[model samples]
Target: MGLGFGFKGRIVACAMSSLLATIAAPVWAAADIVIGQVAPLTGVIAGTGDEYVAGAHAYFAHVNAKGGVNGRKIRVVVKDDGYKPDQTLALTKEMIAQDNPVALFGFVGTANVLSLVKNKVLSDAGIALLAPYTGSLDLREPMNPNIFHIRASYTDETAKMVEHLHTIGIRKFAVMYQDDAFGKSGLAGAESALAKLGLKAVATGSYDRTKPEEVGAAIKAIEPASPEAIIMVSVNKASSAFIKQLRAAGSRAQLYSISVVNFKELLKNAGEEIVRGVGIAQVMPFPYTPATPVVREFQGLMQQYAPGKVISYASMESFVAAKVLVEALRRAGPEPTREKVLAALEAVRDYDVGGFKIGFGPNNRIGSRFVDITVIGRDGKLLK
Candidate 1:
């Protein structure tokens, strides 16, 4: 038998109580700064979501250890939405009513975040959401003052990938995307980028987000074109399945993915041999290389805080985003409000977080437009 309504209600109540307790406890006496995060903590994409939150927490730990911003420690109250938009909206509303987080951070999916924006939750509550994980161009359109983006858009990532492929004389293109808001957003971006170069995808494929294993339809759609390369706008599980199936079908098209796919998860799901030679457009600095000061700092902090966790692009992006948020908090003064934080974020212009540069303006919500392409090498390692 399935869980009854009463049982389900009890579960939800328990979750809400636990979330409240986490925020209320650990009294710093100076009153710790609270931030809320609603993402997929338990679902197909939970691994990536966990790493993102872990990365933000690692940075917050670093900041708190250094006395925090204005002598107040930062604490994040996290709630799991399980990659469901309705759950994201509900959890966010509950967080706002109970915990009263000054800002929302590190939300995972395009549909999940869009639910909040479309319903006027951010504007109605007047809370700023910083560094949501999705790069969909939809978020940037019309410029919601309550939401701030820290990474490059999907458009930027696709343009960079397509432009690089064009330079190498690989003109015939195809796209395989997840069939949802996130997927469609990336597909649109890829098409737009190709159109700018006087070209279009030779083929396109889309698989259901919930039924990633059922990719025969997608394969059938894209196989006939026999394009030289394919841009994949999907997360780990679906992408891995597609790669395995495509390879089994004897397709030799070079595969590329966006930054949203967790490299470690892809390696784990698809194995080193299957994921080998796949290119991915990165929105953040390479974490393993330590070529940049920020990357080195991130590596050191990950060691100190999240000892056993493997450094990854998702974590690196979150770490950098947390740093930007903290910087903005510092500028928001000792007694910070949501409006003050938003103003502080807008005031940031060409601010350097070690080596990585981020800038934002009242008219420009995007903090960075940096995109670099990388490939999977031997032993499931990324080659720059």
Candidate 2:
């Protein structure tokens, strides 16, 4: 079992530059709290995981610069899981035995988390998993005390989009989803939402998450339905490829995606022209819009620490996760422990991270239920 650090060293370096005894003294006097993250640093969904890790890094860096949480700086240790559940399971075990971090933070993928959960990895190790990237009902159902989620669930995102699409007079819905737990969760949500309105997807297709080339087969399934619009639940590459192929095949079906797809990466792969007017359900406030106070802080911190990084919803969601984690740490006080951090997180309620709010309690770990919908405009920006 071996371990590596991602954003911790830089945060400490930034903290030390102050040289003021108050800030510098903490480096020596305070205990450093280490947290582990398992994400896909490579593979098709790589961009989503990479961007989110950068966001968490940016926010943690900002907190460390301001003297950290209760004087103890946070160290985020990251390992690449390659977006594979098996890899996520392996890395998580290594993280527990090797790194022994206080908690598992910002882990990506529904299938990955489910693998960890199903095998009793976190519960067996007695460590909390905080702010997982994917929001599956599987994580929240039966209430696993060790897991805390910051963003809205796939249910929330899909339900909102399906309802919005229905409200806009588009009745015939088609779905193209990845063949995995994440995609199934989104599909379930879409079905539930549509059921509430006495509607259903006219056509649906599933593709393997690991194979972008397989998206062509799913498109073949969706095109024959001739639905008015299609709801997609996939990663950046597969979904981007799906949209490009669907367009090339002369289908005018409106494109809609769940929040898990990174629009920035989608734009890069599929281009603005193909993705223009594509609807996406988002769980975080748009980073480009400074109207939300949290967006301003996130953007400022990203610029300072992750220079030249594109402000993306993926990063913004992780920023929220990092901010909430720091707040929980601060509330846990100076001599923080795994139990204390979990207790503090549970005790959190109506805590404001700038304009947005996060809530948790003894019986609840659902941080926020906020979800929004946006469309990619012709100008290469998300429009509300």
Candidate 3:
């Protein structure tokens, strides 16, 4: 069974209420800051959501241990939305109404995030929506002021992969993507990127995320296209299955993937031999690099909080999101309000956290768009 927060909330509430009564003090002062998070703690995408939540919690724990932001402790109220759009909308509404958190952070999926964005709740309420895990084009284009993205868009990752492929003289391309909004967006972006080089995908295939059997069939159909390379825009599990099937079919075309498929799970499931020579695009610095201070700190935190887990691009993105939120909270100061916090976040320009610098302006909501491409080596590691 999935863990629910209601029981924990009641216990915390009772203890806080009792402490306040005993001390004759208010439970929350005007300066108290609370951030809300809605993620799929249970369901198909739970693993992704759990990584984000864990990173956010670990960052706040560090901040709180160091006396917090301007003497105010940060409280994150997380709810499970199961990666469902309807549940995300409902739970987000509840967070705003009941918890009255200053902002929303770490929402899980593209459809779910887009659903909340469509309702205009974040803009209307002047709340910050930070570092949503999805790389959908909708989040970056025609941007909303309230949503600050720390991760690169799928468009950015796809474009980078296409550029790298072109550099390697692989002209003819094909795409295999999950048939959803994410897939369509990725397809559109890849087409546009290829157009820049006066080229386009020779073939395209898609699979429904609900059906795993269809993925292998789709790959089989696309293999006949005989393109120079195949770009996979999919999650880890589906991507692994597709690669395994493609290898089984004796397809030797170069395999390329967006960051979603560039995960430890993919490497583990598909093995080094299967993933060797595969190219993957990333939006964040490689997790194994210890030269950068931010990377070093993140490594230490991961070791202390989530040891034995191989760090991936998503984990780095989650860490960056936590840093951005902490920066906003610090700028908002002790007597922070929702409006003030949002304004503070908007004011972030060339702000450096350790070594990573992020900037957010009035015209732009996304702080970073830089991406790097890496390939899986024979040792089963992504190397630049």
Candidate 4:
């Protein structure tokens, strides 16, 4: 809750990732550029943060290996917030007040980011928050110059899901979401999407994000309506539990989720039997695909830097975010200031990073509109 040891304890080296004390060895130099992350490293969402940090560090390691990013090595200083918004606010301020990172990158959760924005912390400091890892529409609506998002909005995702399901003639939708900003964001998106199609959700359910294991009641709450499709806007633990319990309760509605739900964690929490045929929208392209240059490059980097770990959307999204951060820093020229970096980000437009394109102009922080759907195959892995 306070300045715990995990603050700045997470070390992402050029060669690899480490959690051990850096003082024990001669590693990072004065020339290395540091980025800060306030993430969940000690809660149910820990694996999500881990995968994201791994991806960002792995990409940075690749960049460092190739003569660094504009002759400066990249390092990430991470703090564990246990997915608590208050902890995120405190540690984020500490990260800025103490570490003096060039940028604040990859903070997870809608509420955490909302806390920062509500207090005007990042904007007040002139620090840019690149890709805070949530698809909340509130972040995108008012056009905060300090925030830049690389993924599709929650509206883009849920609308895509609803549109696809509607095209396939499956209406009668229900929603199960966390009782929080993140969940309500998806709920609003679904509502808008359904409204656009002249349809409405049959039933909806809510569960506490912190008490994710209490998903049985939420599942039972939606059973009576018997929707043909259940749109889920929650994280891995509760979403998987809902799916498991819904199936156990004999509700045969096909389950769908937004991109924020980590499919790997879902698979780990709910086995293949319960998760089969469940659809989830993805903002990032399939990481396993060889055709997409960015994904292929990400795969190669994961092989070299994170060999034993599995490739996931969280990591892949972080890798892309790292690439974007590096490019913007590069554009800021040598000896870049945070203000210069902000200016550089504002100028980005239709810039291609490998296969995908990310663009941001003045008054527009939404980078990409790409969204796709994937389903869990019978074998437990998500299929495109």
Candidate 5:
């Protein structure tokens, strides 16, 4: 009887040990914080998407290598939406179903963000949406509680362009924009800024992205009006085409473009000689400027992660977005919940990360509103 009781006690001890192992396994496993991103990875706007993703990944890799955020590893899942609204919605839904990420980061286009906003997924999920590439007024105006924008709005860029144009004695202006929400938002901002100066656009032209070849005709139509400057509210590809057509047509008007026109791509498309003397409004400081601490750190990271590539405002914005998210996560403390993260972000005030200062409150979702004008010199450099 004593031998049988000892055998049963040993069996009960083994069962208890097995139960404890099962109970503690999950607790011992590494906690993961997933971040979802949707961008135009393989379509017309793929170049922009590439820059954004590169910057974001570089930041994430740097953070992960340094023990991650409060011991929780960050996993970034990027999906290609081809810069289309319907496709973006599908991709976003897939992210929610598969990853259920803590937040959405680096979504590329205005139309894509608009689609998500229309669907109300950000609010429903109570997930933080950060640093969407576009600066559409819709993102700022409606004040979506969960969505936070780190870049300057198109309105801010337009106002700065108009102010600089006025300084340069450019009263007569013609506008060329893509016939979409992003372009329309730019046009509206330009109109509003012009109104402030008691001026108006003398000639206006619009083109659909589907037919970029028609952009030359749009420029031709605007040129006949003989405005002193042409303000282009199109993306990089269309802007390049317009520049080529304008130069070929000998339209000698000064050209000013929104920040969407990638200066590097423009130089490639319409050679340095052709794109010389073009003016652009930049929301962030020049990425190559190693004078600022933030710029130096960004340059270092880019060298480490994405070597030999020119950094642009878009890339810097991506970096700043990552910095802001990391800072919010740090402030959220150990074992962070979604509510803690949101509260931490709301508590952020005058938070300076490198050169950019970000401030978000209960009433303010737009973080930065600063803008500067930079001109492309004859040597293919953006001169401030």
Candidate 6:
């Protein structure tokens, strides 16, 4: 009986010790799924980048509130490269090393994106890049496998604009462009699209990308041509200065621009009367009304996640991109690696996010070609 009692005491003591140790152990929560972005959060085009990142965050926030993707919350880690190419490359490498991000999203400039491609940043890291803001053809063609473009290319946007102008019998075209890879890409597209219709730009003008106000040379070249239409392949600041000066120079040509120019900014900077009737290409759907289910959801999420923020096409594009990224993450299964996400992205075919259709494959990376045109009406509002 004594031996039995001693054995029982030993067993009880062992059990108690085990239980105490288990109770004392720290409970560690699951780590967040980190995504990274390098964009111009400061500089000339800073507003566009801020809107883009905010849109992505709004979607991610919505997803996180619903328990996130596969039980892991998504977190975006961002670094500002200030729209500089060298800084973009360096910061991207830094992000990859520090954050171990599954993918990168919403890089803002043409030169910046091209720098990433040229240096094989995405390929070397074996990561995917989603929805870079610029639409340069160089990024699209020769198909870098690591990059997945969500928005239409500059080539596509320019083709739509040129084709529309030609269809309306508006000949005698003039071209005004920013002196950079972005501007040159748009110029080439405009020229190519015009060539297909047997038309050519009667005059072409260019301004330094950094100094948008120094458009004296471009104006001198283009204004005197007396073209019926002018395709302004530049961003908001440069375009605003050019339009104001061109009008001041007594040129009455109808102005058209690529998707990069924010119409609201134009209205604010150049005034409603000066910007009235300016045609701008749009890659995303209208963000104001519930024209599509995707847009409706975007509006709700924006209000919920980021209340009182101005809704613009730039932000909407990033929002669409975030939704697509979430879908890819879902398809990648519970534990997603960079490789799995890339495969999932490639496998996406006609996947509808609410109402917008996104399709991709092994050979095709550009997700959507849905381009529309909106004009700044006399009242400083975008009109269809």
Top of the candidates by TM-score: 6
Name the lDDT value of residue 287 in candidate 6: 88
- Lowest lDDT sum, 10 consecutive residues, model 6, at 1-10
lDDT of 2 at 105: 91
What candidate 4 gets wrong by more than 4 Å, as runs, is 1-30
| Number of clashes recorded per candidate | 0, 0, 0, 0, 0, 1
- Residues 30-106, candidate 3: write the lDDT tens digits: 44578999998887656677777876676787887787888888888999988778899999988998998987888
Residues 25-107 of candidate 5 have per-residue lDDT tens digits of 88575678888999898787788888888887778888988989998878899999888889999899889878878778899
lDDT of each: 0.90, 0.86, 0.82, 0.88, 0.84, 0.89
- Candidate 2's C-alpha runs over 4 A off are 1-28
Which ranges of candidate 5 are over 4 A from the true structure?
1-27, 308-310
Which order, best to worst by lDDT?
1, 6, 4, 2, 5, 3
Writing each residue's lDDT as its tens digit, candidate 4 over 1-384 gives 776446345333422434345556768454777788998988978888888888888888888898777778777899999999999999999999998888889989999999999998998889999988899988888888899999999989999999999999997999898999999999999999999999999898999988987887677678999999999998888888898888888999988999978776778888888888989999887887777889999999999998876688889999999999999888987677779888988898887878899999988999999999999987777899
Per-residue lDDT for 295 in model 4?
90
**Clashing residue pairs for model 2:** none
Better of 2 and 5 by lDDT: 2
Over 1-384, each residue of candidate 6 has an lDDT whose tens digit, in order, gives 454537788899899999998889856566788899998988888888888888888899999999999988998999998888999999999999988998888899999989988898899999999889988988888887888888888778888888898888998888999999999999999888889989899999999988877889999999888999999999888999999999999999999999988888888788889999999999888988889998998998999998977688988989999999999998998888899888998998998987888888999998899889888886687888
* Candidate 4 displacement at residue 300 in angstroms: 0.7
Ten contiguous residues minimizing lDDT sum, candidate 4: 10-19
Return model 4's CA RMSD, one decimal.
10.9
